[model samples]
Target chain A: MTDLEAGREALLDHVEALIAQRGGVSITLAELAAAAGMSPANLYRFFENKEALYEAVAERWFAPKVRAMEEVLASDLPIRQKFYAFYARRLGMICDDYARDPALFRSYLELGQQHIEIVRGFIDLADHFLAELIAEAIAEGYFPGLEIDSAVSLVNLMLQTFCDPELVVMLIHSVSEEKLAIVVDTIFDGLRGDRPSNVRRLTRAAR
Target chain B: MTDLEAGREALLDHVEALIAQRGGVSITLAELAAAAGMSPANLYRFFENKEALYEAVAERWFAPKVRAMEEVLASDLPIRQKFYAFYARRLGMICDDYARDPALFRSYLELGQQHIEIVRGFIDLADHFLAELIAEAIAEGYFPGLEIDSAVSLVNLMLQTFCDPELVVMLIHSVSEEKLAIVVDTIFDGLRGDRPSNVRRLTRAAR
Candidate 1:
């Protein structure tokens, strides 16, 4: 990586440390720059403003999960195994991140909400993965008769506790890694066309 | 109710209004009493302190849901129907409450964490109901060989987005009433032991 890139990441690390210490992102830009041994003008050159810096921090923290998800989605594993592996990796990373610096993680979620665009890419990426998987599941005769959009919505909603940052922070303690696997397995059960033939499907029938 | 009980309920309503206006419970006892046209000493007669008032509000907000869950548990409906009705009522109430006053709901969640004991009773009550339902599901051969505790954890983890105050607030927008039903139906799919009898069960075998 370039030295400039390394310097920017180092600045983010400092900002994250400040947020963790104060339990929020209440530090001023000048204070952040000073703490990183840089002038305010120098920091501004890297990040247009505090919001920009926060956005960068959020993107940095989430980039790895996005990359990992992409790798999982691209692997040769079956769709069902891909689904399990996808969420298992996410749950583990989020839990570890939360456990390490809960305040920073909380700040990251608040930052995401304050600047929705900051998290939009990640949300859209996950949505894309979920939609693709649902389509594959249907093509494979699983979740038969379920429309892709509705299936995406259902699976996304079911996985929110594990995937949504705000929900993950709230539920991380109760939802251990084992519990996440079970929840994923349960969702797979739903998607596997295993409901008794007698149980009427409540969702709209696919064309 | 006695005249004193009426006065106390009125006080709680006033406190809730203050919290809504401030988007938090930052009002002083004097302010709360002044708003209610009462002396601080009189307010003290009702609640010991700010924490006590917050706890009361938390209890008042959660009371109906708990009562509704109890009714569902006691009703003669099938175990599956009871589960659906239970979460449906909870989802509706929480959504309505969140819509009516987002700030107050946020404050309630913050208060819940600041004072865990305030929410302990509600958690224990729900855990009890979940355990009971899982036992019944087992007795009915729904999730045959699944232990009650594991079943309860799995179901509760799956339902966190709908039931946990913090998670519900985070996800209430994406998870509509229709969506919650679909998710619950998905969970019921998991519990029904319809995994084709070929898939190996990952959970402990019920003795």
Candidate 2:
């Protein structure tokens, strides 16, 4: 990377740490610059204001999510596996972000409708990709035929579950990557047109 | 109702209306009393303080939700339908509250962990009910055998979609009882062990 790019990345990292620790209130451009071994004036050259700096921080975290979705969609994985991989990767992104710095996650949540709309657009992109995959899978007889709308709705529902604040808090108290995987698998099973072999095991266990 | 009961109900209604209209900040004992056609001093006879009154208001709204879950669990409906009804009712409560006063909903979100934990407890209650229902349904041959833990996680995931702020916001923009019903039906269909006939219709329509 270029020197300027390295400095920009360092500034973002410093800002993310500060935001995670202090939420939205604690960080200032001067502090961020000082942390990066630079001056406030130099920081100003990079970002116009606190909002710009914060937006850049969000973009840095969000870009990877967009890329991950794109890669999953472009991959040759079966529809069901693709869906599971998508949710697993997405949830991992959220869990990691919350663990690293919750304030950045909070910042993303507090973003204006415009920013949310952008995020939603990306979600829609992911949803459309999944919908297409499901349709193709059904056509190929790899999965039982199912309604695309309900399938998309199910995918969206699972995604929302990963994003729930209360669930995040609960997970914090009992953090388990395995449990998260089970949650993902269960959702996929519930959404599928056919039951997995473990369905009987689950039912018997329930009884 | 007795005079005291009637008066207290009136007072609570006014508090709800005011909080819904102007938010938590706009509420005051004097204003609530005035709106309720009672004296501020008389209002204190029924409640300790504003916080107490707010809690009462929440209880008034929340108790019915608990009762609804009980009714769903006790009813003879299939486990999948019961789960759908439970969440659909919960979503209805949120939408009703949001419609009555956006500020009140905002207050609930802003009040931090105490409020959020209360909400989570309600969801946990629902989860327990669902876990039992799934167990019973499986035992009775209503569903294909499934892992109890995985089923509960899936149910929780599907339920969370109804309460997700982002998804709720999206729904509001295109709000309709019909649309909500469709969404709810889609969810139930997705959850059912047997695929619905309309799955093909949904798939084609979504694309």
Listed models, DockQ each: 0.31, 0.14
Candidate 2 colliding pairs: A147-B203, A148-B203, A199-B145, A199-B146, A200-B145, A202-B146, A202-B147, A203-B146
Q: Candidate 2's residue-wise lDDT over B142-179, tens digit each? A: 44444766556655554555654435644564433333
What TM-score does model 1 achieve against the real structure?
0.83
Model 1 interface Cα RMSD in Å: 5.1
Against the true structure, whose lDDT is highest? 1
i-RMS, every candidate? 5.1, 11.5
Q: Judged by TM-score, which candidate is best?
A: 1
Residue-level lDDT of model 1, residues B1-207, one tens digit each, is: 997778879988897787677764456778988999988888898888977776777788788998998898898776666677778788889889889878778977775677787788878988998788778878887765567887787777677777876767876667776666666666766654334222223222211
lDDT of 1 at A64: 84
Task: For each candidate in the order shown, give its overall lDDT on alpha carbons.
Answer: 0.73, 0.60
Pairs with steric clashes in candidate 1 = none
Over 4 Å off in model 1, which ranges? A20-23, A26-29, A39-45, A101-114, A192-207, B26-29, B40-45, B48-52, B101-114, B192-207
